[model samples]
Target chain A: MKIADVETPALLIDLDRAEANMKRAQDYADAHDLPLRPHIKTHRLPRFAKAQITLGARGITCQKLGEAEVMADAGIADILVTYNILGTAKLDRLADLHARIRIAVVADNAPVIEGYQARFDDPDHPLGVMVECDTGAGRNGVQTPEEALVLARMIDAAPGLRFLGLMTYPPRDDRVGARLAGMKEAIEADGIAVREISSGGSPGLYSAHETAGITEYRPGTYIYSDRMQVAAGLGTLEDCALSVLATVVSRPTAERAVLDAGSKALAADLSALPGHGHVMGHPDAVLTGLSEEHAVVDISACKDFPAIGEKVRIVPNHACVVTNLFDSARMIRGSGVEETVRIAARGCSQ
Target chain B: MKIADVETPALLIDLDRAEANMKRAQDYADAHDLPLRPHIKTHRLPRFAKAQITLGARGITCQKLGEAEVMADAGIADILVTYNILGTAKLDRLADLHARIRIAVVADNAPVIEGYQARFDDPDHPLGVMVECDTGAGRNGVQTPEEALVLARMIDAAPGLRFLGLMTYPPRDDRVGARLAGMKEAIEADGIAVREISSGGSPGLYSAHETAGITEYRPGTYIYSDRMQVAAGLGTLEDCALSVLATVVSRPTAERAVLDAGSKALAADLSALPGHGHVMGHPDAVLTGLSEEHAVVDISACKDFPAIGEKVRIVPNHACVVTNLFDSARMIRGSGVEETVRIAARGCSQ
Candidate 1:
């Protein structure tokens, strides 16, 4: 069915564009001789994850254990959960996922290491544990190389855990490779065998080859580049595949029009961009305000503002958060909706 | 089951507090002898909607046709959908709900009224249509009372529609009541009987009795008061009934710790507030940054900071958007997870 026939405030995915985005990122990783492990947080669809694997990704990366479980149900053999799985309930599920597939996880703190070591007891089939290094992104990771070595030794000494190389959500600092390389050397010198250094960020994926230490890269948002990616200079606006198909419900004035898609659909994530999203074809339309179900668009810059009942497409600021808001998405192949795809792991933030 | 056993990044609803909050709003409305119609957008639960009605609410208000349909399925008799229902798909669903129970929808434009008129063709059971007026909210509404009357005449002229009265998402302007009061007189002077002047806002629900024109008041977030409401001086911190129960996943530094709940859970609506949310008991803690799954918190103001693996409850900036993020919410009665209730209309933005 045409997107027009579908309900308003619905998520529209341009599949051809997404597939091309996938191939582009995968090709870039392939050219750099880095195995691409696309994060499933962007689309949250098992079909897209499988497609990425088909396009030569070594495996898939999930941010949460719940997401990994969903990917595993789709018969994905290799998975990497990029989170510190703590608490009894989560660790119990982590053990279940570990028993079935070739999986790995990352941790930066001692408590997380202790939790992982306590869960997995079989020394023969040791679980791969990567020491998350901060590098420069002041989010989650060890601060220094010495701290990385400390965590590396903790994992290597554990009977059930093997020390995998460093993992970093590389900071904006271009010297991230040098930092990880230095940390890897320190950890290896301290008697832990470093295996693979994994680093990722969609904004700096093209420069993967320049980063010396990392063996593989995980780029999640590459499948559906959003306005955030465009602002970060990662991809052009045409590369964005997902857009909220919303109808202009109210045009109160020539300078202002309200769309049905709001914070609930578009997400209120202002990830480095000025507004909530970018309205396609209306470069001048600024989404100045977003109530729960209404996106108030500033149409003063547009010579001819859209009228009520007209459908407009909006590319959200952050694609990953947008994926978590909806239950399903309409796949647009060529010009029309091919099928409706369930966001099987939509709210898998556990 | 204990709440600690429940997974992190879960939406928590304190049933006892929510019930008290409901009674408080209902009592205030009862004292003023005004009909109270609590908007279901905040909770999206028919059980709670029924509870509000049980406590002497006129009916429940909804923001979408899908939400009204969900409420109707749960035996809710009356619902006021505060949105301009446009397009064929939505109008079809609106008609389906109108056929089942008492449902009224608002419109600010001619296209929406035309859509309603074309679908609803029975004057004997004419659909209730409120002319949404833009007093000062600058969102979805007719520009002036003149525009409101024009839309009111359109609704009155339609054989299948009846002009209910004036409707306003009562803007912050104190003269909103006077503006709408004037609109009511002008429309009535033109021979169209104004039945109900529906006005709503969570922040100003307590002062609703002070307003002149509104015959009924609709307060949504008061049932599950949030940080935004608290900031707007609507209620105290103890009055907030809903919060995102998240885990402290990473304590990267002494001054900074990260929670599992980010924009996906807490929402990014900085509604007259400084941070993403208010970390209960940690008034000094500021939510500095929000990635998709990580909320970077600044805890420099605390004497004793939280550690990794610890759970913390956070009241989001906006409760309505947070409700839409989760598939289900854990109902906390006293100190535990009483049960999980499906957010029946969570993603029902259509």
Candidate 2:
């Protein structure tokens, strides 16, 4: 189906472009001799995860157990949940999942590792635990190399938990490579051989390849480069494969136009991005504000603004969270709708 | 279930409090003799929609056709979609839904109405068409009384379209009364009667009683007051029954703690609120930043912040969009987890 045939405010994914994006990342990993574990949080569609694996991805990384469960149900055996599974409710589910699949989880605290140890003791399947070292994003993970070793030692000594390796998400700094090398040295001094040093970031994808001691990479939004990615000089508009197809519901003035898609369609993630989102084809128009059901587009910068009822594609600021906003996306191939892929794991954030 | 037994990053709804909130809105509408058409965009849960109708809501008002379709499937016959339905795909779907149930849709542009008229030239059911007049939101609606009259005349002349009345969502200004009066005078000049003049806003719920021409009031977030409603001084902390139950995953420093819920769960809507979301019971703490799976809380103001692994409830800035982010929300009656209500309509925008 053509763009006009499809519903407005719908998600459109170009499969050809998506597969090409998948191959580009895979080829880069192959050339670097690094294991590519594409994060499924970007698409949250099992089909996309399968496509990544089919394109030679080693495995997949899930941020939550709920997301991992969806991938696991689709017969993805090797999964690494790059998050701290906190409570018994989640730990129990993780242990059950571990019995059927090769499951690994990351932790920065001893209590979290101890909780995993207690649940996996004398279990049917052993659990792989990775020590999360903060190279300095300041979200989760151990702060220093000394703190990383302390958590690594605790995991190595704990029953039912096998110490896999070190994992870190370094801050946007120039010394990330040095910090990763230091953390790796600290772990080796504790008599723990680091097999998989998972490092990630779309902005630091190239730097992560150059960084020493990083064996695996997990980057989610590399497939669909967004406004933030473009602004950071990471990717171009041509790299953006997914966009929100919205119609101009109201043209309040020549300067302002309202689209049917709002915060619910295009999420409110302005993390490292310059603006809310980029209006495709209208490079000058800025999505200045958004309500629940209306997006305020300032077209004063553009020589010709779109009239009311005209359709426009929007490249959201952040593609990962934007994927969670829609239930399904229309897969487009050669300017027509091919297949509608269900975002099966869209809101499985338990 | 006790608070400790519940899962982390789950949506919690207090049934007792929800019922009370529903009753309060119904009682206010009854006392004022106004038709309470509760907007279902807030919860998007059929159970809550049914509860609203049972508690004396005249009908439900949905913002999208996808939402209206869900309500129709749940046996909600009387429904009003307060959105301009554009395109043949959406218009065809709207006609199909109108045939299946008692439905009405509002329009502000001639092209949208023309599309609706072309698709349903001889509709199976009379399509209730409300002329959307812009009160002051500057979103989707006609700007002046002349525009409203022109659209109203067009609706009257169009086949298979029943002219319902006027609908407008005013700004935060308390001048909704004067704006509705202007639309009323214009409609009377054209020798047309408005059967239903619907005026809506949770902030303007009280002031709507002072408006003369408004026969129906549609307020979506009255049942669950979010950070926006609380910041608007429309509701208190006690009135907010729905919250994102998240666990503290990391204590990065004495000043910052990262929770499991982030933009994915809490949503990125910073609409008219001081911060991303309000942490329940921690008035001083503010959600400063959000990554995909991490909600960075700046609890530096709190003398004794909760330790890592502790659970905290977050009343998101925008409750409507937050509801759209979850697959299902946990229903809690009194002090126990009653059941899980499926958010079936979520992500059904296509």
Candidate 3:
């Protein structure tokens, strides 16, 4: 099917642009001699994950066990779950997933490590555990080098578990990278061989190599730079490969029009960006607000306004969250559709 | 299965509370002598829609033609699509739906009416058409009463289309209701019998009867009131029927705790509330931020912070949008799960 033939409020991924994006990031990783573990949370489709691996990514990173299960089912072996796996049911799933694939997980405290130890104490294959260091972004991880050592020793002492290294999400500035490097060195001084120091963030991807003692990088949104990424000076609009194709469903007034896509289609992630999304080809027009299925637009600033029934492509504020909104996306090359890839892990948030 | 046995980051609807909510709204409509038409966008389940109908709702209201198709397929004979139906693909679907069910639609402009006229101008059965009146919410509708009359006359003049009446999404304040009543009176004076003046909003559900000409009320969120509704003074936390069951995946620090459910499950809709969601039983805790599959909570104010692996229920900021995020929701009767209902209209946004 052609691109226009696909229904409105649909996700369209430019195949050629996506390939170029993957190649660009992979080249950067190769140049820096850093193993690129592309996070599949950005595009939950297994096909895209396989393509990332084929494009020279060492492995894949998943945020939840449900995502790891999807990657494992798709035959992607090496997986790193970047979040703590809590609860018995989830731990059991994690153990089963580890048995099939080479899986590594992260922990920030002793309680989380205890949960992991309970499930993997006597497994056939040892599970790799990493101490998550909190360099700057206060989402998850240990606070200091002393805390990292504490968790590292606990993982090393646990049965059927191997202390891998250290990992942190979104080391905002250079100081965080240097601090992580210091933590790694301190842990090594305690006679523990740090296999890898993983740090990740799409905003900080280019600077990831500059982070001292970092051997691996995990960047999800590099595949689809969004309005937030653009605002962060990551890349220009040309580098954004994903766009939500929406149709002008209503022209209520000269200044106000509504698109078929809303929070349900484009998501409500503000990303601290102006409005909900950036309307492509019409920078003056802003997405004023969104309801469940209506994206309210203010076109008063625009010299030209989109007419009713006309389709408008929007680069959402955060592409990674928008990817999880749709069930499948139309992969288009130029004006034609390459294929329809089902977002296999669209709601795999277990 | 049991409630605790269900996986983390799942949507759960307390069946009893939902029934109470639906009954309360239905009773209010009955007392006001107005026909209740519950919008299916809230629950999106055939069973819940059927339950609303059995409890005295006249019919169901859908936001999209796709949602209307789902309702019609589930034996719902009457439906009103509240958006301007544009484009040939969607018009064809609307025509097919009208052939199967007693369906009605709305339009605000000439082009949308022209499209409907092209398909239903000579149909086997006449289709109900309403002139969408933009009383206050400037999303989709004609601005003034004169504009409403123009669209109403166009639908009235069409061969196989019947001008049903007027409909507005959020009839804000009493002024909007008064204006819509004036528009209906003006159109009727022009020899057009405006049957069924429809207006809808959960916030304005109780005040719907205050409108002079509104004969029908459509309230969706009353079925599952969310944090937005609670903050709006429509209800309280006890009145919210839906909650996301999440597990404490990590306690990275004394103040920060992460939940397994994030934007993918809870949605990133900020409801003018302090945070993303309301953590039940812990009013002091704030959902500070959300990643794809992780919700970070600030637990500094809480006297007793939840430990790792413990389950916590969160009331999302917006209920309708949260309903669209899940594939299925667990129906609970007190502490026991009644059943799991697949959200039939989850991604019906074509």
Candidate 4:
């Protein structure tokens, strides 16, 4: 079935383009001799994970255990949960997943370490725990390398946990190289051999090799560059494989048109882009704003406004958040929808 | 099955509270002697649609055909789709739905009316078409009352379509009542009986009742007041029945604690709220920013910081968009989750 035959506001994945994106990232990893753990949180489809693994990805990186569980179900043996897992319910689920698959999770707190130890105490599966160091992003992780070492030692001494390495999601600043290098030396001073220093960010993907002690890389959104990627000068619009296929539901004037895909489908993320989203074909058109089910596109910037009922593709600002909005995306290949891949890990933010 | 028993970053709906919300709206409609056509787009749950119908709703209002289809499956007879039905594909689906149930769709353009006429020409089930007039939102609908009448005449001339009445989604400004009255007179001047002048909004629900000519009211978000609603002075935070249950994933500093619910869960809509989202318990703690998987809450305004692994509920700025992010929301009774209700119409943007 072609895209015309499918529903509007549907998640459309250009498979050939997607595969090319997967291979390009893999080729980059191969050229640099770096271990590539493609973040599954972007596509969240097991099929894409398998394709990445087939193209020689070292493993997969999931943001949540729920996402890892879906990947594991699809026979993904090695998984790295880049986020901290706390609470008995989550830790127990993590232990069960660890027992079945080669799994590792990052941590920065003693209570989280103690929780993991208490759950996987007897004949522990040697759950690999990475000390999450705050490189610059102020969301999570320890502030300094000394603080990371403290957490690392606590994990090493824990009954069921194994101190695997140091991990940090650094900010997209120029100081990332210095921060990583400084954190590495501090960990080494504590006599802890950092086996896998997993550092990742699409903006910092090129700088991965420069960071002296980095062993593996996990970048999710790079697989499908979005409006954010283009704005950050990471990738172009053509490199974006995922687009929201929406119809011009209303043409208020020659300058304005409203599409069916709104914040619900496109997501209201303005993180790495100028507005809510970008109209794919109409480069000059600006998605000025979005209501719940209506995307207000200002076509005054374009030479001509699209006619009402015209189907337009939109590249959302952030692809990862948009992926989580849908249960399945229509996989388009050579102008036809080949299959429907379920976004199985969608809404699994447990 | 307490809320504590359920994992964080989950969607919770207090059924008793939701029922109360439903009843209050129904009571208001009865007291004011107005037809309550509760918009189901907010919840997008068939059970809630059925309950609304059972609890004295005149009918149901849907923003899309997908949502209308979901409500139709639950035997919701009278359904008004408050959106322009564009393209042949959507019209065909609309025709099928019209045949199955009493369906009314709003359209603003001649081409949209032509498309509907061509599709439903057989006359087995004539489509009820309302001329959508732009009161002031500037999103969709005809700009002037004359434009509204022209569209109404076009629909009246069409063989397969039944010109029902005038419809307008007024802006959030204070001039809604006068606009509705003017549109009513314009349609009445053409010797056409305006059976329904449907006008309503969660923010303007009270004002809609004050409007002289409106026959029916359609308000969706009132059933679950969001941060937007609260900030708009429509309802209080205590009136919000739905919330994103998130865990403190990271506490990087005394000033910041990151919740697992990010843009994907809480939504990045700062519509009527001061910031991204509002932390429920810590009203002073503002959700300053959000990544795809982490919400950064600034607790510097509060005396205490949220500890890592602690659970916190977040009221998203826009509840409608938040519903679209998840497939199912856990229904809670008192403090515990009773069952998960599928947001069946999620991602059904077609």
Candidate 5:
């Protein structure tokens, strides 16, 4: 099928640009001597993860066990689940996956450790564990270096777990790096060697090297730079590879047009940037509003508005959430349609 | 499977409450002399649509061709697609479904009419078409009464198309009803009978009776009232039948607990009621933040914060969007899992 012949409200990925993006990030990580473990939570496509691995990615990072299972099913062996696995059902899945591949998990609290201890206390084959540090996002992780040491001690003391190192989601801020370094020092003072310190954030990818004692870097959004990345000064709009191919279904007025893509397609992730997304080729147009199935566009300032049934490409505000909204995405290489690839981890939100 | 063992971050629907909510709306529409065309976009389940039919709905409403196709496959013979059918691919599907079911479509532009004329100009099998009016939502539809007349004339002029009447998404605000009524009067003055004036919106479902000449009413979210509906004064929290069963994945501190449900599960639809969602039992707790995989909750104000791994039910800000996030939803009867129903229309965003 031709790219133009694809249906409206569909996900379109520029394969060439995506490959280039992968190479760019890999090159940066190589130059800084950092092993790039790209997070699969962004694309959720094992094909892209394999492409990244082919381009020299160390492994893959998944935010959920279900995502890791899908990635492993795709024959990608090494996986890191960067969230706490608490419940028995999830722990059983984690243990099963651990037996199959090199899997590592992160924890920030005692109950999480206790759950892990109860399920994964087999001394024969130990599970790698990392302590999550609350650098600044304030969403997850321990508050202080002392708390990190406390969790590290518990992981190292566990019979079936090996204390791998420290990990933080957005190791963007310098303070986060300094805090990780201090925690590592405190952890080593207690006679436990920190083998790996992982930090991840696309907006702060370049800053990953500046963070002291970080050995591995993970970046999800770098594969598909979004409106947020561009606004965060990570890269230009030209670096964005993923775009939603939507048709102007209705022109309510001269100043307004409605695209088939809405929150269900483009997602409701409002970046720090103003509108919902950037309408490619129409610099003056802004996605003023979004209903479930329609994106209300204000095209009054455009030099020329698109006609009804005209297809328009949109770079969504947050590519990660948008990628998860679709079941599959059309792979396009310079206007030529490749094949449609199922997002193997699209609804792996467990 | 038992409801407690179903899994965390799952979509749960109270079947009893849903039946009650459906009956409540059906009773109101019957009393008001309006044919209730319950939109299938909320539950997107054939079971619920059939239940609504059993409870006295005239037909069902769908927003996309894909959804309508699913409903048709499930023996729903009468379906109204409330979206403009453009492009050959979608039009082919629409025509195919129209051949099998009593299907009606809406249009507000010439290109849309031209597409319909090209395919369905057969006088033998006329297609029911409605002129969508931009009453007040300003999303899609013709701007004025004259524009509605123009579309109505075009529909009436087409050999294969029958002009049904008018339709608006949100029948809220007195001005919208006045405008719609005026448009109906003007269109009828042009010698074309406006057989039906369809108006929809759960927030304005009760007030739909106040509209001077609306012949049909559609409400989707009434089957599952959400936090947004409550804040809009549509109903109370008790009226909400759908809730996300999310587990506390992590408690980084006594004040903060991370839920397994995030934007992927609960959605990013902000409510006027404040916070991401209403934590059912923890009235004082606030869902302060959400990422792709986790919802950061603030439980400082709560007298008793939930422990790690504890499950909590949450009424999402928008129930319709949340329904689209999952592949299936668990149906519960008084806290016991009755069955798991597949969201047959999920990813039917095309």
Candidate 6:
């Protein structure tokens, strides 16, 4: 079936651009000597995860145990869940996943490490526990290098756990390397080997080499560069591989029109750019507002305003969130659909 | 299962509060002499939709054909899709759905009506079509009452379509009744009978009586009031039936903590409130930001900060979009879960 045959407000992933994106990131990481560990949170499809592994990605990074479980079920051998896995129920699943494949997780606090210590005790498959440090990005991590050492030491002492490395969702700055290096040295000075210095962010992917001491790069959004990534100097609109195919259902006024896709389809995240997303081939038009099922666009400056029922592809502000919005996406080779792929780990947010 | 037994970052609907909310809306509409056509976009569950029907609702309103199809399959005989149903594939689906149940659709443009006219020629199953008037809301509607008459006349003239009424997502104003009355009179003068004047918005549900011309009220968010509803003066925090049951997975600093529910779960729709959501029992704590799988909370003013592993219930800014974010939700009575029900129409964005 063609684009018109499929329903509107569906996800369309350009295979041509996506393959180029994968090869480019893989090639850059290979040249820079940084082991690429692609995060499956962006695509969430096992097809794409397996493709990343085939392209020489060392392993995969999941945001939660639920996501890791989907990847593991797909026969993904090595997985690293980036969040601090707390609570008994999730830890139970972590242990189950651990028994099957090589699993690693990050911890930012003592309680999380203690919970991990209680469940895991196998020497043969000691769970690699990494210390997530706050090297500048203020999301989830220990505040200082001293705190990283404390967690690293605690993880090293646990019989079921092994101290793997230091990880950070680093700020896009030159000092990211120095900040991560400080934590790595503090932990290594205590006799624990800091094997991997994992730093990640799609915006900072090309500048991975500048962050000198990082052993691996874990960029997620590079696979489908969006409007947000373009705003961050990642690439142009041409490099974006994913878009929401929407239909213009209402033309209320000469200057105003509404698309079928809204916050539920295109998502509600706004970038530094003007609108919530970039409307391809309609540069003059701005997406003024979005309700649940309608995206109102201002087409005052448009030379040719879209007629009612005209299909338009919109590149969302944030690509990762959009991936989670749909269960399945159309893989497009040029303008034709190659296949429909399920986002296996879409809502696995444990 | 109990609240603690379920995993983190899941949608929870307090069944007691939800039933109370349903009764309140039905009772209010009965008292105000307005027929209640509850919009199923907020709940998206057949269980709740059937409950609403059982509680004296005239019919259910759906935002899309896909949502209507789900409700129709679940034994809901009467459904009004409050969207401009365009395109051949969707019209084909509409025709199939129309043959099964009593279906009505709204349109603001001639193109949408023409498409319906071309496919539907069954005088026995003539499509019920309504002219959607702007009436001061800038979303999807005809600009003026004159334009509404044109569509209404066109719909009346079609052999396979009947001019049912006029509908609007009206602006919260005292003049709503007058605007609707003007449209009704204009259409009636053109030799077409205007049977139903439908107006919707949970914010304006209480003042629905003041809007003189409207015969029906379609309040969606009243079933699960959120921070947006609270901001709109619908109810207090006690009336909110739905919330994201999230776990505090990271305590980065004394002021900053992170919940497992982020944009993917809680969604990124911001209300008039200061934050993206209101955390139950944490009045001072603010949900400052949200990534895909992490909600950053600012708890500086809190006397009791949530520790890691503590489950927190967050009432999102908008309940409608949050319902679309999940596949299933736990129904709870007080704090205990009754059952898990699928959001049958979640992501049914045609």
lDDT of every model, 2 decimals:
0.88, 0.83, 0.88, 0.82, 0.90, 0.90
Quality class of the docking in candidate 2, CAPRI style: medium
The residue-by-residue lDDT of candidate 1 on A230-346, one tens digit each, is 888887999999999899888899889999998888877775577889998898899998888889999998977678888889999888888888888999986689999899998
Q: State the displacement of the C-alpha of residue B146, model 1, in Å, after optimal TM-score superposition.
A: 1.8
Give the distance in Å from residue A189's predicted Cα in candidate 3 to where it truly belongs.
2.4
- Using DockQ, rank the candidates from best to worst: 6, 5, 3, 1, 4, 2
| Model 3 stretches with alpha carbons more than 4 Å out | A122-124
Q: After superposing candidate 2, which stretches have Cα over 4 Å from the reference?
A: A122-126, A272-275, A305-307, B120-125
TM-score winner, 2 or 6: 6
- Pairs clashing within candidate 3: none
Q: Residue B48 in model 5: shift from native, Å?
A: 0.4
- Regions more than 4 Å wrong, model 1: none
- Residue A164 accuracy (lDDT) in model 5: 98
Query: Which stretches of model 5 miss by more than 4 angstroms?
Result: none
* Per-residue lDDT over B128-182 for candidate 2, one digit per residue giving the tens place of the 0 to 100 score: 8998877777777887788888888888877788889999887877666687678
Give the deviation of candidate 3 from the true structure as CA RMSD: 1.3
Score chain B of each candidate by TM-score: 0.97, 0.96, 0.97, 0.96, 0.98, 0.98
Displacement of the residue B73 alpha carbon in candidate 3, Å: 1.3
lDDT of 1: 0.88
Q: Model 3 residue A295 lDDT?
A: 95
Candidate 4 per-residue lDDT over residues A1-350, each given as its tens digit:
87876777889988877888888888888898999888988898888898889999889999888899988988999999988888877887987898788999988777778787787765446788898888888878888777777887888777677888888887887687677677667877888777778889886776678777778998888888888877877768888999999888888777889898887788777764566777876888888888778998888888876688778888898888888877789988867898887788887877
Q: What is candidate 3's TM-score against the reference?
A: 0.98
Per-candidate count of clashing residue pairs (backbone under 3 Å): 0, 1, 0, 5, 0, 0
Listed in order, each prediction's TM-score against the native is 0.98, 0.95, 0.98, 0.96, 0.99, 0.98
| CAPRI-style quality class for the chain A–B interface of candidate 1 | medium
What fnat does each of the candidate structures reach? 0.81, 0.70, 0.92, 0.75, 0.87, 0.92
Q: What's model 6's lDDT at B327?
A: 84
